[model samples]
Target: MVRTMNKCDETTVLNAIATCRFASASDAELLDAWTRDQLAEAFATLVNRYSVMVLSVCRRKCRCVSDAEDAYQTTFLLLAKNSAKIRHADRLAGWLHRVAQRSAVATLNRTAHMSEPDESLGEMVVIDNPLDEIAARHEAIILDEELAAMPERYRAVLVMQVYQGDPIETMAERFQTTVGTIRGRLQRGKKMLADRLRRRGVVPLIAISASMTTQVSSVEAASAASQLLGMLESSSIPPSPPLSESLLNPLLVNGRNLMSPWNLGCGAAIAGAIGVLLMGPAEGLVGASGGDTVDVVMAQKADADSEAAAVQFPAVKPADLSSVKTKQGSVAKVEKVDDPEVSELAIRLKGELDRVSDVSIDGTVESLADELQQQLGLPVLLDKRALAFAKLSPEQMLNFDSSQEPLRTSLRKLLDPLGMKATIENEGIVITANPSQLVHLGIGTDRWLSVDDETMRLFTEKLSESLKLQFIESPLRQVVSQLHESLGVNLMIDHRALDDIGVDDDFPVNYSLGGEVAAYDAIQMTLRSYDLELTVRNNVLLVTTMEGAEESLLSRIYWLEGLALDGNFDSLTQLIQTTIKPDQWEALGGRGTIGIGPGERPSIIVNQTYDIHRQIESLIDTLRSNSFHPQSKDTGAHKSTPARFGNPASGFGGGFGGGFGGAGGFMN
Candidate 1:
């Protein structure tokens, strides 16, 4: 017996609903009128009733007003599209709340930029206190754990009351139970949640009331609702009729007059227009004279379709250099670049250094350098002053077999006391008088350099492949020295500090690692006996006492903008762990974690060195660059999932340390 509004305008209809007491109509009644009678007023009434609630959810989840508004529109649009699927009208509010949350999450995932649209729109400033941030994270984790541990039936009722703001009557009807039963379930759910939270040392009790409330005005809601309804009505395409209607007249197509040729042509034209709109503007839609040409337009459209069909999708494939071979009748000679050959030689030298070999040499530093130069076919420069300063006997016998240990380890054992270190240079391997001098020659920042996960993995693999080790009670210095030589990594040992701790070069280290264990792991095993640890400082490895290393473990926070929006948290975390040193992460333990903030920006929390933090930031930058193009090819095989790292051609050389030469050193 309700009267419909005569006027189609939003203000008039809203005024009519208010005056006629239609504003207070139940959602079930409004939905019935809209679905059964196709009454525009009924649809408008539903929108007005729930728009404020939807807006509140959006505002709470979104970073800015603009994003919230987009989410708001999307939520209601989805509700309208799926109206027929609503089986329980009384639970409509709860359903809408879920939809609003999903809409906001989807919106956040789609947009990378998360800045406040306008400060005047009441954007909340996030506090940047470390203690507060940690507390909030712990509270959220504890709450989730407690809720998940609760019984299903009790949990459901509690969620309905607290999160969805459903009345007790609505809950009873939804569960098909008595009011007393619903109240009992709510009470039990609350008590169980409180007990769990208390045991976990979180809050003593859970809040039963809804945390979020609608701050939007009735007038604003009415205006937004009216606009949404107008969009739906003016779509120029009607909603599909019920299955019953279609079944009754299977041959009769709705929205067109099949008997009239003109009506049929108009329908076809409308369909074509919709296709064009969905696909974006077509080429040659309008002629140069600002008029339409049917034949030319159709030809262009046909061409576009053909081109789209002909385009081939990129596939993961391996590089095929064999295809460069000439046909039987042709003769072609491939020319190699001298620079590339030199670079290849350097790579080979590193491989050679990794191989386990016996070294039984009784010679001076100069003689050792000369022998290495001749064997490796590369220049080996020894500092004369460094040798003189060491005051070693001219026939000092340094006899040891690498026995699968890294060449660097053997070299370090030979040269450590001489106040000299060997590093790869553009010219050749230079046995320099000062280790600090070599740092100056490296590329990028001396303090910190970026190394990707893939590069780190490849570096470790290469090191493992080159090394062949079997050690049973080897000197600690010799073990570390061999590891350093094969890896070409700078290992700075604090001898003075080690002496104070009653540990020295002859400290016995025992390991049974055979085959190709990772050089990093081998080094760690050797250091474990002395209670020593390794930390990276400006790309140099510092093998020092654990106490000294602990001083560098400082907590830092970094804002990883756009990472959460990309929706690749798992991939990103994996990439980080793979790229960074395993020992460094282990040292951080539970302190190292990444989380998506309320505003959708990802934040990294870790206790690490400043250099390590810089490296992480670099890796994050690389991830952001590859965010848009997620998939990558490898060895002709199509990746089942997007690559954790981008194209190898993008460059992933260099170790966790800085570049050694112009060549992308182990982690560059």
Candidate 2:
């Protein structure tokens, strides 16, 4: 067989495959074997023969040479894999071309990190009205030059689609991605091609026919230009064959029946062994799937996927396409706000944080707060609403920057009606409130935010990290001081105290918040006691001494669900004492509201899971107790608790509780 052959159109190649008689009866079978075995060499041949065409397509798809190269390599890889199944020699080129085209498109999809394949590539192309008479040959040359000028990635996609002839769906599946992703890529590729053409003087205007293409000068046209044009006319170049058949596997694998009897036997044996192992006594040692672990892992994976799957949107609206050529770039937009108060608050609050950008924090916080209210089944408090005290007003600002005594006095006056108290400290603040206060405020920590030894460890670590980012290593103290003045509070660190804790005040802290080792140690000392162990590394504290720690941690997280649901405080306090063994808590649950009681309202703790039935039961018990009952409720005089727990607006029973939704002072 000849190693090199004359250049021919894809159609001519297909005809040769259909007509030529091979010398051996097993030529088809041998070719099929060669498809997988010598795919590299076979692919190299295809590339050598069609490199120019491929380059042209890629040029049209990308904005630069590097991008085109990526697309080209990707397309060739696809061809190498798919070439084995092609049965007929005549149809191979056509098939291969199509696959190559799709591969280019897939490359764009992957690079752009899209979720869907674009279907708009076959749409009409528009050009300016004036360039029609430049001569067909000249137009082809111009188009070629323009395509080559584009980035490599763009050029590759164009080559794959327009020149290689691959379909959209094939490209999507080959890339192991979604159709939306492919479509997004194709859309980007088209816009780049259009832009390149325009820059090269081929303006794509409304007047130009979308179907315009390069044409060879006709004999009659040649004659018109020069009275002897007929003598100078030449035959037009024939169109190449379609690239579709040249690259498909002749033996298509049926997806539905992927496993043959032999494969099924192997799979069944493997499954059985896995099942047996899972059923063994060692299964108990395998442990329960930690819910918190799963949740955190899932959350992390979701974030990564979101980042990687961002698609570059086309300028064309999802609803309309004719107005713009393409999207310039992908970016977030800021919201328009007309209210001065809300705008001022947003600006002030956003400036006081880190890690999050200024433009986003304001929008996100308000949005999240609104969502939280809805999730908790409560109406949000607003300045214009009846819950005036809940809103931040002039009276609410009572010397927030002053010493603890004045601050505490002002907070007491503000929260007295709600039965709450505030404990002010230089470095910490704790809020104490009754169960009724929690019910009214619809805000409190629960299982999710519960202060377990581990949680305290995590929180302290996070705080330490935050402090480090803001103070220890940061030169932003001056800026921080200014912010404290604006917010009316002092945020300072004692260099000596930090040194005593084994952390250098000179350590630079990142602006992002997350407690460090010292923070965790402080937390252990101040909140969790010695129930948990803490170690610091790279400025991060790892607290991991609790026995059955994973299970305990999960429970703690589940308990937070109660907090998110707006559960009461004392009941939660009781639940913790009952659920966690004394040995586990280091005797922390023995005093005050720290222990559980049937009549108390639930405390919000992190990592606790309770069903609706338990939640209702808990609420009922609290309403029957004096903790949430109004002072007028004279036990026996109250007659009896209501059959069903009613809304806060309606009292639980005669004179038990008349109103709902009260303020809860901030936890120090």
Candidate 3:
């Protein structure tokens, strides 16, 4: 006999099912009633009958409670949207189960990188039958695999019928066919899906019954059904324009409303009044017109002068125009005002610095700069006196392999040989002879090399290549200085912060580098013991203390449960203390804390950088994995001690003891 359970009066439910003729009705009959007639009661009955099984499958496949709920909602929403396409009502349960699992897996994959567990959705009821749960989960997996392997059209039809709950008539309209054609497609789709599953050494079946009862609240099921129905109704309406694109288009600003005629008329009236006031009376216009014209001309010139003064070029130095002379022996006019065309050209060139090109420089700096200017569509300024002094020969060719390098890097390589540098200053890239002067001019220092994460990783890998080097407790400061000198890169250290951390500049560090050990590895090994690390910030090598580095790191909280600690809070607290170490925990200045309750589970709170937190999390996982199980025979004696308050051994229900209790106490 077909039976169903609801979280309402059993008698009432049976009576309602019998009165509605749903007691012996197949899934297809209910689906047809709901889809064709918009029967809300029929839809509610279907949701109540299947939500438990769908949620059970979702919880088994999902990693978190929120994901399970999300999958559950998505499964029903899909069904509601495509209620008309279901041909085989008997297979609806199996189809929904598979879809729920797929949705859950997708959600888990999307949130895999998120550290903190989601607590937004209500908790799922724990399943008691482990074997049954495993079987259901396995069946769902087989269905998912088979569904994935099906042809696109077959899968779409199957999803519409089973997952989306689309009526056959609606789907026929959607696919531009008759209801019989849609039904044929559904039958073929299900058969193909089953065949694929059988080929994979498994047979798909509706092992879990839709009639199986669950403790899931009827109110929740009814609510979900109502929402699904609303969604179905809303989906029939035409979609509005995208907010982002609509806002960007000036003519379509604020969705269909532009500058109204009223606004335009008001603006015109205001303009007319302002003109009348400015021109004075019309009777005196001829006499005062000439003076007014002169006044307007003077006003425009003053406004132009003010605008020019406001355009300040911080990178350009205030040098005499006579100092710069062209090859023709005449002083070149340097406009004090900012040139809009030159500014626009410079912006474009800066954006295209990563463009690949083949450049062959076979002449003097003057000729090379001129060629680059014409090729790149930007001005390339070179000091005339400096270029003349170098006196480059035509045969002194510099062929740049820019295919693998950016334009900026190639330009730097070309200029460095002449004891000069090419810097992107305001309106142009200026070639300066004095490297130090470039810094003062605010050109070189402001344009640090921008490296992506992948490039930096490769750089570190290269630096880690094995090198033979040895240092016997050498002062870290001296070692860093030597390494920086060898690498020809700037290394900065916070000497004051180091002193505060009790690390002197002359503090000794030991390292022995040989074989394939890279210089980068050696440096890291030396700093490892001193609680120091190397970080690249703003394109500069920074050597700082671990504590100092934590300032820039993100803070996260983690919850751990089912630790099987036998309610022994003292042992748990001691274990955590030993794992993290008292000195290290204290050094965090209350940023990290552990809380043990009078239960098996405990919580750990850590405030550190993401990298450091990952290390701590790994340690905790190891401890949890190695923890003694309460169910084991050897732990029977420990389990007998009833959980109570104020027990020193239990570490709860009374006064605080040692370890975490003495440090920060248990967190509720």
Candidate 4:
């Protein structure tokens, strides 16, 4: 009877393993001699134990419910395939997590088609006996209340630890942060949880026992663990969180679709003008080929070179002696001997000439023509033989054409040069001229006067000082102010644009609040000011300001627009009204001043696209300023995925170049 009981227990354990594959090293040796049917039974045991956890991981990381389901199945499939290579059962949970994570990321990169968070969950389902289920259901309500109320960072740490049961090391690894940081997060998370429970009139059990390495020891943490188990165990757990939304759903949609509300609205209209005629499913809108556009613009400029000869000046005419003003104060004949294109006859008068100060001297037709030809160094044929008999050349016979008055007027200036007698005091007054020579200097012509080397050096110093003063009165101050406001977060704003010259970094602006605050705090304050609350997690920013504040998701949308277009308040408002779902508006702080709902979260997820959109919009603005049209989809080709052993990971989309992953630093 004892032997039979032992056999029964063994059989039960083996049956569980077949269902879940949750077996340790001891089971490995037994499985070595087991048939295929026995191995399958062992795998099943492991599955039954951890399937719930695996599904949760999949939902958290994947694009859609279907995707998550697929991922869960795939993980099991992989386990079955690699049964022979099984090593330790204790690591199975971690291995399963890795598999799911990879699957989620892979699916997102390949086809990012996740729906928005389920709206159905927002409306409470009617239960037949509400009072009977109230006790068990109340816990879920409390948990939700606590979670929704907690700071985003703390909540994130709690979720990862409690619901996911992820090891501290794994959390640290996932966030690409240190164990110390994870510990810090866990400690703070525990305190916040305790505080929240106290607020609910529940005396929270909270303690931190010392552990050897990076490990958290809290009674509340343990309680949280038990609550999680309870929630998972009961499929009908009241107020179960809507299925986890996609990680990539906040950025890209399936194919060329951009997940942002504003993108959907405007992207449709500007498809053609932005270079892509249509934004079809597979063939998303693409701008005019960049290479072709560049070539066409260059070719247009190159075509103008053929017209240069038409503008070339005719051969210089000899001075007509008949018009020479011989009564001169000084005949200071200046000569340029290099090419001798034309000879200057500077016959300065005693004072400024009466009507037309400059004059051209007419000489003997023949000798003048010869001198003109010799000076031009080009052969010219003269029409007059009498002029030729005096050794005249063809170049000298070239006369100014007055067919076009403007051309005639401009050409006449070459023959009739300005003349003046040198005064004793003005012996070396440098000639004033305007040339494109100073373009090589960094200053642009629009904002700066291009001067010669001597003038530029002197002007740069003076201009630099003037700019310093002007910067103080400039709108750049407002830009910086708006930047802080638009980010909805506190930043170490580097006010060094004119700091060294005009304002120091410490010099407070009108809106400056003396000291810095955490970005989360600042974001919270900003959202509250707009009657909203922001919630942040792993780069996801959720606006959970109120029940009515769900409408403020519209404002959050405005924040996105503001961020994209450098705080254009008008655009921000318009985008909000256009992009947000009507129901979500109530969840965001709606149209009031600093409204707060029960358990409002200040900031939840950190939206990375806020930065990306800002950059793209900045680029668009720059392109417009430079008179170059920008394409709509600035995102490059290639999607983001993990690296395989044989093939390096490659981006596979038409957007930001970087792949999807942790920030790989504390800063993320």
Instruction: State which candidate has the highest TM-score.
Output: 1
Off by over 4 Å in 3: 1-21, 84-98, 111-140, 147-668
Judged by TM-score relative to the true structure, which candidate is superior, 3 or 4?
4
Models 1 onward score TM values of: 0.29, 0.19, 0.23, 0.25
Candidate 2's displacement at residue 264, Å, is: 56
Instruction: Give lDDT tens digits, candidate 4, residues 1-668.
Output: 44555533454454444544433323333334332554434444455445655554554455455565556665555554444454533234444544545455555665445676443222123345656233333443344345434434455566556555668777655554445445655664565566556656644432111000112123322322233333333433223222232432232121121223334455444433333212212211222232221100000011221100001112122342223222333222221222222112211110111112222224443343343334322222223432222233434433332322221122223222211001100111111111111111211112111113333233223222311111123243353354445454332322322222232333322223345554434444443332233422222234332322222222111001001121122332333333333112222212221121111001111111122222233333332333221111111111111222112112111011111110000000
Q: Report the lDDT tens digits of candidate 2 across residue range 315-412.
A: 22234321211122222222222432223222221111111111111123124224323422222222222223232232332211212232223333
lDDT of 1: 0.46
Ranking of predictions according to TM-score: 1, 4, 3, 2
Better of 1 and 2 by TM-score: 1
| Selected candidate, larger lDDT, 2 vs 3 | 3
Separate clash counts for every candidate: 21, 110, 22, 66
Q: Which candidate order results from sorting by lDDT in descending order? A: 1, 3, 4, 2
Candidate 1: which stretches are off by over 4 Å?
1-9, 12-29, 111-117, 120-177, 188-223, 236-668
Task: Give candidate 2's error at residue 68 in angstroms.
Answer: 22
The TM-score of predicted model 4 comes to 0.25
lDDT of each: 0.46, 0.31, 0.45, 0.31
lDDT of 1 by residue, 231-254 (tens): 667765333321222221221223
